[model samples]
Target chain A: MNDERLERYARQLLVPGFGEAAQERLGRARVRVVGADAVASAGLVYLVQAGVGRLWIEDAEDVSPSDASGWLFAPSAVGSPRVEAARAVLAPLSRFVSIEPYPKGGVPTATLVFASSGPQALASAEAARRAGIPHVVVEPDAEGGALVVVPPGAPCYACARSTAGAGRPAQPGIAALSALGAAELVLMIANPESTPGRRIDLVRGVATARPTSRLPGCACGGPGAGAT
Target chain B: MSASAPPRVDVRAYACPMTYVKAKIALERLAAGERLEVWLAAGEPVENLPRSAAEDGHRVLAVEPLAGAPGAFRVVLEKGAGAAPEWP
Candidate 1:
């Protein structure tokens, strides 16, 4: 990251472990965000702020009144397609970082894909699984924001869905969680030294959440790579 | 069912994936064991209708030619017993 880029992301880069190098890593990375709703909006803003090099957003949805409740979008954006609205928000953040917005929903070429909890988020998760792309699905909690990380190919979003007995396809209160979850996922993908099958979580100021333990024979490369 | 029940979907103007995407949404709203009847134009759905329905764990009860419409077909599908889909 150059001096100009560092100044651009000064707030985030000022954090303890995150600095110019991390911002540089983010700039060199390609990330795919499925769905540009409230949660995705929040998560994407953070990623853009961090200067992720290439952002591929897949959503065929139009901006509705509900999206105005989130940050990064204004009331005037109502009825505009989310891709168009988001491009305007992201353009000012980083000129070096390329933004590729897909009007139709499908997998784009990316190193990491993030799906926030919702119907479309789940659909994005399913598509990523089917395409063999690494992904993370996030859901946030009500109090001070708790994050549940569904890392790619491990205890996947599908596995979490089944385990949680998620009766509704997309559960309620999923938007905030999904966005925060995706932000964390971008962080993980941006860090090159991160080992495979790593699971970590953060509860605002509480503590850093780590996976209970690596799942033995987990296809996330903790053990078995072919276990699905 | 009524003697003159409305068709569940009219897909004359849609293309691939849009057709399938619309069909999937309709299927999601249906109760288990119920059927959705779809009418499509003379293209992809002739084959894609059955393929997409099967992929969703639904049963394609019938796929027959529509009278007076060249290359068009009517597709009827019964929703399968499974967890509700995440997407429509």
Candidate 2:
């Protein structure tokens, strides 16, 4: 690795098993993010800091006044498209990573879904799974909600999503969930075959994790890779 | 048989954590039982690098002053099995 990259990701390189090889893997990752709203703010920042090679932000919504209350969007950026505004802020965080709006026919090594609604999260995650790549999905609610991790071949996020109806509007605490989700995705990118199918819930600031299983005959339990 | 000189890294210009980080990356590239020679400044680097390497399951073979280089030392390390058990 070069001096610039060494210094940029020095901390994670020190993580056991996160050697030069892992750093190179991270630098080679093309990660698509499904939302750039307040719910995705912290995760976008996390991905940039972790030095994923490319960030393809897939949001189509304008920044809301509430986005400024989150991490990335500037108050003045409200009304601009969220992906552009987010790329504007996240781009300067690390020169090692390339940030842009998602392109048509873009293929990502992994996906991160910080979807504002359940349907969007499900569809984004389903697409990633069908592509046979890793993905993480954040479901934010008023207190805090859940995030599902679907490493390739693991149970589908659709099977892992919360049974409860979409709970409430995203709360500030959703930052914890988003950041945690980003961490999960980073680890999966760094160690592709090691991530498990799981769900982590953050309710009123506490977090709990459990392994996820596929519904009978779910697509994830198809020909090759089966649910854990 | 006379042993070949081990791979070397100079961390004398860096401090604390980075000194260890540089040495660790050098170690990461080598196979288990391969030795690495790290050149670092005497005080903090001398005090920390050997301990850090040992803590990560590396063998601290020697800590000798660099010839004709003031306030710098050479730490020789042998790579250990797998990675540190501490981090999973």
Candidate 3:
């Protein structure tokens, strides 16, 4: 690592299990984020600050008025395309990470999903699982939310996600929850074998995490699964 | 095998944490029991680097001033088998 990178990641290197190796893994990762709106704002910010080498933003929505309530989007960012507006803000935060729209055939080493809708989240997580990459899905509900961490092949996100249907009203503390999700994603990207698949639920301010299990007859248990 | 002098890193220009951070990176690149010599500024860098390295399981063999460089000290650390940074 160079002097600038050493200082840039000085604090992370100071961590117990973290060292130059993990930081290098994070710096070399290509992270594909499935959403870029308000719900995905904090995660996107965290990913950039944590120094993922590349951020492939996959959203195709315009910023809504509600987006301003989140962490990254300024009020003026409304009416602009979600991915571009987010890139404008996030790209300035880290020089090492390349932020851009997700190319149609782009392949990422890891994925992060913070969708506004449940179906979008499910599809993105499934795609990442099928690709045999580590992924995290953040679903923010009122006051709190849940984040599904799917590390390679430790029981996929589809089985880990809560059955709560779409449109869970976003409330205060959602951005923090999203940031937590991003942190999980960063850890998985750094050391894919260290973390297991799990669901972390934050409800009414308390948090609980439990290891996930494969659903009966799930395709994830079929041939070619469990890549890691 | 004949023993040679340890690897050296000059962190005199960096402050508290980077002083130790650069030294740790150098230690990580070495095999077990390989020693590292860090040249850092006196006071905070000198005082903290040795303690921090000791706390992380590396053995601190020496902390002494450099002859030519005023207000700078040299620290010698022997890398531990594995780093065990203290936890709360």
Candidate 4:
């Protein structure tokens, strides 16, 4: 990486495990964020700041002042498309990354997909699943946030959504929850550890956590389950 | 009514996606940085629509349900200080 690039990401690169190699992995990776609203505001920003090589943003809405009330976006960016505005924010921060602004509906090829756009993005996420791509779904609540990651060969986001009854579209909420959820998903994706085919539920505020396995014929059908 | 203020549009009767759509139409026709106050009935749009407006770069002043009209909200969406984009 060039001096400028390293300097731009100096803070994150300072992390012990996120040296040059990890940064390269981040740069070489492709990420698609389905919704660009308050819930996803920080997650998208974090990924961009982390130097994810190419970022694809899909949201079919315009920015509003209230949307900027959250920390994720600035008031100056109100009325801009989420992708365009997010790109503008991340551009000067990292030249190594490319941000593609796509209207809602089109699903680009991505190694990982983050669903924060409610249900609309989930349909497109299904397409990614059929293509066998790893995906993570984030739902941030006012109290905290919920993150569901579909590791490679793990149950897809579609199934997870269905299982959680969040398979359909819904409204948006605070940026904190969404950003935290996005961070959790990204960490799981970057490190396999012991979370595969394992479903985890947590209450960030209460510090309560649970891990469970899917039952047979639960519709996920395991990693071999057919992509819908 | 303040002589300086224009009439507002009510979008509370609408739902998600459409809430964003109607707000977009209003914001587009409005002058730069003009305010378009929308009233949205309670539902998914409450969550999705404001976020949509913010995502597209509009300004959302406030979002609170109407009194005794649970789920309905009076939202004030202000056009940005710049020109609005062409509607999709």
Best by the TM-score measure: 2
State the lDDT of candidate 4 residue by residue for A90-159, as single tens digits.
6776667788875456444343344544565567556665655556666554445455666555655555
lDDT (10s digit) by residue, model 1, range A118-208: 5655676666655555566544333223344443444545444322322222223444455556566665654523423333343443434
**Residue A38 alpha-carbon offset, candidate 2, angstroms:** 0.9
By descending lDDT, how would the candidates be arranged?
2, 3, 4, 1
| TM-score versus the correct structure, for each prediction | 0.53, 0.92, 0.91, 0.56
Q: How accurate is candidate 2 locally (lDDT)?
A: 0.87
Cα deviation of A30 in candidate 3 (Å)?
Answer: 1.6
Cα error of candidate 3 at position A84, Å: 1.1
- Candidate 4 structure quality by residue, lDDT tens digits, B11-61: 665554455655665666666567877778777877776776776677888
Error of 4 at A36 (Å): 0.3
Q: How much native contact recovery, as a fraction, does model 2 achieve?
A: 0.28
User: Which candidate order results from sorting by TM-score in descending order?
Assistant: 2, 3, 4, 1
TM-score of 2: 0.92
Error of 2 at A175 (Å): 1.8
Could you give the DockQ of candidate 4? 0.01
lDDT of each: 0.59, 0.87, 0.85, 0.60
DockQ of each: 0.01, 0.38, 0.37, 0.01
